[model samples]
Target: MVEDPLALWKALRNRYNHQRTVILPRARYEWTHLRIQDFKSVAEYNSALFRITSQMKLYGDTITEEDILEKTFSTFHASNVLLQQQYRAQGFTEYNQLISVILVAEQNNELLMKNHQS
Candidate 1:
């Protein structure tokens, strides 16, 4: 469950900030605008996907990321070749967003575990 949307927003901002620094030649335009234009960012890009997942979850779609990876890996997944190619060309922007969320959650979980262990 999402504990705090504000925290999530901040974490996402930080991730984008780091990416902007590490990947030189960052997009000249603002992310919000770019998000509108290209439908990038977690909220803008994956909101619908997440909503669908949430609905599916209510209906027993409890597939984990591992399951997703396994399925994608197994199918030789070319469901949307053009979209896949575009994502690849853009360096897996959606995947990066997902990674950012996972990293944040993992870090938070580790901290909580450490606190509990103490």
Candidate 2:
């Protein structure tokens, strides 16, 4: 009954892509709503962000820097509030700078945990 395997493949691909596009906004919304309190560790937080971004990247030119930044900053946890305030005081208004500060803070937290254990 496989009269046209290539055609069937194209149809399935189209359906999958359509579904992906349909949910892109919802995915971004969930990501923006994700809070630092949701994760107990830096690895968990980073992994969640990585996964969401990887999925969104599949949409090619559709994802925007503003969207990513809004999600990244809006989901700040209590631990990150200090860094957020400090960065703002230092005039670090750029999204990239904020990401860097957050990553560094995560690394520092990891090191502190390791040292405490040792």
Best candidate according to lDDT: 2
- TM-scores for all candidates? 0.26, 0.58
- The number of clashing residue pairs in model 2 is 0
The whole-model lDDT of each prediction reads 0.45, 0.68
| Tens-digit lDDT track of model 1 for 33-113 | 222124333344345434444444544447465543332223223554563344345443344444455346556878999
Instruction: Tell how far residue 109 is off in model 2, in angstroms.
Output: 3.1
Q: lDDT tens string, model 2, 6-102?
A: 9888878976867676767766776766765688764577677666776677755355666655565566676777765665566554556766777
Which candidate comes out best when scored by TM-score?
2
Task: Give candidate 1 regions above 4 Å deviation.
Answer: 1-42, 67-97, 101-118
